[model samples]
Target chain A: MGEKKFAIIGCQHNHIEIFIEQMYQLGYSCAGIFEEHDRTLAAVIAEKYEIPLVENKLSLLGETIEIVGCASMNHEKIDVIELCEQYGKSIMVDKPAVVNQDGLARLEVIIERNRIKVGMLLTERFHPAIYTLKQYINQGKLGELVHIGMRKPHKLNASSRPAWFFNKEQCGGILIDLLIHDYDLLRWFTGKEIKSSAGLVGKSVLPEHPTFYNTVNVQVELDDGLLTQLYADWHTPSKSWTWGDGRIFVTGTKGFAELRLSGDPLLGSSTPIMLYASEEEEWSKVDLIQPHATITADFLSFIKGEASLLTHEELIKASRAVLDADAAVLYKLIPSSKESEPHV
Target chain B: MGEKKFAIIGCQHNHIEIFIEQMYQLGYSCAGIFEEHDRTLAAVIAEKYEIPLVENKLSLLGETIEIVGCASMNHEKIDVIELCEQYGKSIMVDKPAVVNQDGLARLEVIIERNRIKVGMLLTERFHPAIYTLKQYINQGKLGELVHIGMRKPHKLNASSRPAWFFNKEQCGGILIDLLIHDYDLLRWFTGKEIKSSAGLVGKSVLPEHPTFYNTVNVQVELDDGLLTQLYADWHTPSKSWTWGDGRIFVTGTKGFAELRLSGDPLLGSSTPIMLYASEEEEWSKVDLIQPHATITADFLSFIKGEASLLTHEELIKASRAVLDADAAVLYKLIPSSKESEPHV
Candidate 1:
């Protein structure tokens, strides 16, 4: 196999650093980098990872460079995506890919015109616990999946964040930012699109971030009759053991499964996936290979002519569904009342 | 104090028997029982508990019977409350106290005119873990309470449940029948009235229970800024460890507290309250007295002219708040979108 060269554009988001490291681990290193307006992030990447920085986006788009990894601010993602498509390089970008319908529509044209593949890394899926969770679901060990509970609490280091990070116009809201992970996984795990949803939003914790909702609780119904709840927060206190406090509880017909994506908050340490099947009397942990590296390997294989995990159409559908769900909650849309109301 | 006398009316609900049993353990015994129809329930109470069945509601209202415990189909509960009020007897009834505004208005008139004491047992509160959880909150071990999560899954032995139990007009749906407990405790724990709420409901698991949602997820905001989520269902399969798979996760400024009310699903047995405090690196179990018996004792004291855990007005306010929240979910009320929605 030829060396799969890759370049980074917009290194401001944290996920970009992880993507570069994962790619490097799979016998590929950053071939070059470019950040048009500011080189601060580009300089950091160059100095820290010893990767070279190019003068512009054009200088880095090489012939053998099979993929370009983009991590611009959510509202700013379409530009990077278009630039990557212009060079005919397949793209692996951070989530939401684009924030609203306009950006999504524009990106859609770029992908179709260039016939380029655009993938979202969604590293949460690569957590060992989550990888094993999917394996169990496919094995039918968890039975008919019914409910999924998610809590993704990311620490907000106010002093370290860029001004745009706190602005909704630039970053999208909390749901589009953090919960897009849950939305993507919800469909993949349940094998259904969201049929309906409702959300409760609060700004109780961090008043300083006026554009951010520090806490959000959203409940969604999947087409396959699955009910799911996602709780996302940017207020996992400054002193917590991990940068994020994350948990996923999947309840189904045959039994229940849980994953502590970060460490076990109560135990003050990280743990693996735990499964309790219908017949089992105790929780048993599932074992797996290092998840991130495996995900990287899988991505490379997909780039190397293997069948894609997500169909091109499925990717766009998932993106649009996620945005609609976000709007349903953010717009506080009143769902048409169910005819058979539960109340007397 | 002299022996406290009690009476039971409308044996349709199972919780009535539990409340009576707990009261008996506290030196209070049922002076009489009454069931206008369905001798089956009355027969069980007479033969097993050996409490005598009365001819009518008035017959049970004796001089020494300072309190009356009423458990009827929710729609039939208001008449029982009025009967108790007519006799000037204090009332202990199942929730929701009323299913609609008309019932609530009628009950309000009786409560005001008779100035009667009406308390709900909310026995889930008696769960040992929950008792310990409240203790932690009161002690400020879990500081500045922020969120409470409830999962109440009632096992649906479909063939065993009465017809009225499946009727929304009678049982007040899943939220009223099940989530009412969480709502009552939410106020007591957070010390706030509900400010707003949103609910997502489904009838996915049990198609037969068409009138009932069977599954509900409601999120509420308290006046004090506490955010709470309640998940209630009557579709718990027969093989589950307990009739209810209940859990409460309370997160606060200082730490997080959790309770497994019915039992720990993973361990296949009951669990103690678990608390993870900020200063502590590990979770510790919180000790508490037998919760139900303690609650029973408190009800007895409040009936005997002692200080109340809640004022008479506060009790009514809590009941009304629970019903309103249920209706808010049932009617699918649209909340005005906040200028800044929580996301990312």
Candidate 2:
């Protein structure tokens, strides 16, 4: 194969940095860059990665680059991805590729008409602990899977964010932006399609940002009677050592595991994976298992006409699930009276 | 106050041990004991605490015992509590004081007719970490509270459990039996009544116990918009050092705190209360704060005609909330189809 090359058409979010670094590790060099709105982020990334900035997006899309990695604004992502699809290039982009149902519908049609791979920066799928958990599940270490609990709390860093970050119309709700990763992992870990999903949003801490919601909680059930809950917020306190304190809990009939992905607070920043199996005497910490290939590696392989670990259809399904969850957000006043009303 | 005295009327669950120990610490001697169902547990407690076991329950309830502590089978608790109320005696009991709505309604009427205090052994309320957290909230150290997450995982220990433990009708299902603590704590910490609560239950492990559910997830919204999620399961592996690995996460507008109550797996079983405030540099551990009074102390004060820390209304309210939550269990098939139907 000739030199594997990818071009960056957008750099609105810092996740583009992860996409670039992972691609570099897999011998896929950045061919060019283009960013119209967030030139500062684009410039910083260009200087750091030593990539030249293209004057226009088409200049990079028209080049011989086999992949386009876009981390544009949430609402604008579908536009860039559709453009890349029309250019006959596989795409890798940050989460909430489309902000709302309309954008998702448009992207679906674009994917149907175009024949190129699309991947998301759902980085948790490749976390060392999650990778090992997947192996254990496949090996039946955790017998019949029961429930999963995930928490992703990120520091808002409001002053550092662009204006568009606070606009719900442009950024999508917290459900789609923060919970999309959760929906993806629930499917990946269970290998079962989502049966139903629902979410509730609140602007507990960010009232000044009227259009923004700082907290979100989601509950999802899988096809085969497995349940999962996700809690995400933009309210991680400033004193938190990490940008986000992320963790995942996996339960099974034979055993259970808790992956402290980051911000252990007391136990250093190590991703401690604690396991308690039926035959063990006490809960023990499992060694971290780092996988050889990353998500970018699989995307690179897909663009190279090889089998993919994550397929385009799965990406769309997960995205659709979150968007639908966002749509079904309940604004009803939760009754405090003496009645048991079913509300999600 | 004239040598505070209490008697044990039921010992179906081991929690009676806590009830006895705490009452003794508050200078209340165990006047008598009565247990017909679990003679083994009753005999063990009798030998350990050096209290005599009475052949009939009324012998103790009819005595000058100012308080009756009951830990009977789930469905039989109301009968014991009602008898104690008829004798004009205050009572403290294990959780799920009543199995369902009807039981809650009956207990409500009994409490109205008899001017007696009733408290459930929602022990987490008095945990050093939780006590400290409550102090922080009262001190405005954690700004306006945003969200709370709690996990309670207990080793099923099926072999050691009574047969009634697995019967949903008898045990009140996992929602009421396990999540009652969560409901109580949610009210105690927020100091706000619950607006709505819902739960999903699954029998992930014990198929033989068809009437039992081993896993439960609950979501509650406070009247003021504070949100909380609770997860409880009976699948804690034998390797777990503690009966349950319980933890609580408290999020606020100014900061957040995570209380590792037990079974840290890596960290020793110290109840590490980690705090991350806006002004701090990093997450730091706070020294445990032991409260001067236990829950039983408060119950003793209530029985002695002194002001009660936990009002009878609050205990009944928390129980009613969980019972109502259990009634609204969604057996709806979570749709795996494209549409996102709202399912709690």
Candidate 3:
């Protein structure tokens, strides 16, 4: 296939460097980079790669780009989506796609009216070890799925975030920002609709950001009697960054498989994905797949109609699960103020 | 003090065998074993140990035992407390000492009136590796405490117990049954009161018991701004007689430590404690201490007046924290019933 041309929108995210590198490696030609403002890292990266940085989103509408990669951090996703829709370009947006149901629905309607290809950035699902694990499960290597547990413990630098990132109304807190991956994976592995879920969300150490929840734990029940538990937080101290780890564990009637992505400094900057299987009787260290590359490839394939990418329906469903979990934390599942009062 | 004599009350818990071996090893003479009704295993163990089987609670009270180890799985701890009060004997009671607030209050009144020594069997607090970690923190080895995460996953046999055990009113579900260890440890390590907590609790696969929450995930806020997350479940399948694996990860400003405790053969267990220090150059394996032995030693030391045991005030506070968390789960922190809907 001929190389596809892509433009970048909302270059305020941490993964922009990885995205640009992956796009280049995948033989995709960059058309231009567009941001609401100039002199951002996104613009710098674009300039470093010798790509034109377009200042206005509207200017990219008539460009030769076939796709736009939306890499904006939280709260700016809605604007990115609207611009992508206006250009009628296939787009890949980072999670969470939007902060609330209203924003999510608005974006959904826009994408539907334009018939533009839309994909949510859930790069973890494309991790090479995760892909292999999915293949193993599909081959019935783990028997009938029984239970799944996932932990994503990330330490966010309190000093580094855009102030809006910590506002509940802006980012939807950690449940949405961090746990969207869990919600998607629960559906992906169990193949069961979520029957019910409850979550606990609140500020941990970041008293400076009282409106947002920095820590959250969610318990979800699936349609087929599978139970999934997820714990996500941004409260670990700075010194423990080396031990920052992400794990996915799936257990079945026959055996289980565990995939751990370690952030230990000894392992270096590149996180190795290690997979342990009952059948294999040993844990095999697997090479890491550049998630951004896989995601870009998948998006391109979907746009070419060569393969079906994660559909908007799936993204909406996953988004709703995360939104519902957050709502459960904020309104329904958490105790009322009066109820929280100590009795004695 | 001369060799102390002890009697077992309610010899029905799964840990009764371990208690028996521990008592023997600790140089305590078995006054007798007592249960409401006789079971072959209990009778056999008592007989094998050359300890007579007492007929009832009255016989246990009437014995010359200086200590009573209430190992009953039942939550009717008030009766045991009353017996210990009447006999002026010290006691170690298996936890969830009383299932409800009223029962707990009554036990408290009786213990206060009798002025007898008591120990709540919180063996997890005394777990060797956990104690070592505590020591490191107490000595400022880990620097400023930041965040703590713990998980306990287990499988219970359907034929194992009476139906009442699954009832929240009776056994207090997974929160009190499993996560209490974590709750206690959090308070122990932080020396801070739990200001607030929220939890998600629900039944997943154990359809036989719909009312009981087989899984729980709790996020607790401490007065010191420490965030702690705990997960507990009793629905994973077991391959052998052993079930459950536990992990505790503590992250501090200076370093971090991760502890894993494995379950029995039919149940999964955790790996031994692994300690990682950023200041130090290596990851080291720490020794595991026998928890029950430590509990026994603590009780003995308290009885000898060499050290003060965990006070009633501490026990009540810890129990209150656990119960409050459970209540949060039951009430659904948010007011909307729809938000409490399960996803699975």
Q: CA shift at A334, candidate 2, in angstroms?
A: 12
- In each prediction, how many residue pairs overlap at the backbone (N, C-alpha, C within less than 3 A)? 8, 3, 33
Q: What stretches of model 2 exceed 4 Å from their correct place? A: A1-4, A263-265, A270-278, A331-344, B1-5, B263-265, B270-277, B331-344
Candidates 1 onward: DockQ, in order: 0.15, 0.47, 0.15
TM-score of chain A of each: 0.88, 0.91, 0.86
lDDT of 3 by residue, A74-133 (tens): 677787877777768778887788888888888779757857877777876777767667
Question: What is the fnat of model 2 with respect to the true interface contacts?
Answer: 0.58
Best by lDDT: 2
- Model 3 chain B scores worst on lDDT over the 10 consecutive residues at B330-339
Provide the TM-score for each candidate, comma-separated.
0.84, 0.93, 0.80
Over the stretch B13-104, how does candidate 1's per-residue lDDT look in tens digits?
77787778777787787888888766677777777888887787778887888788877878888888888887788888866778767788
How should the candidates be ordered by lDDT, best one leading?
2, 1, 3
Docking class of 1: incorrect
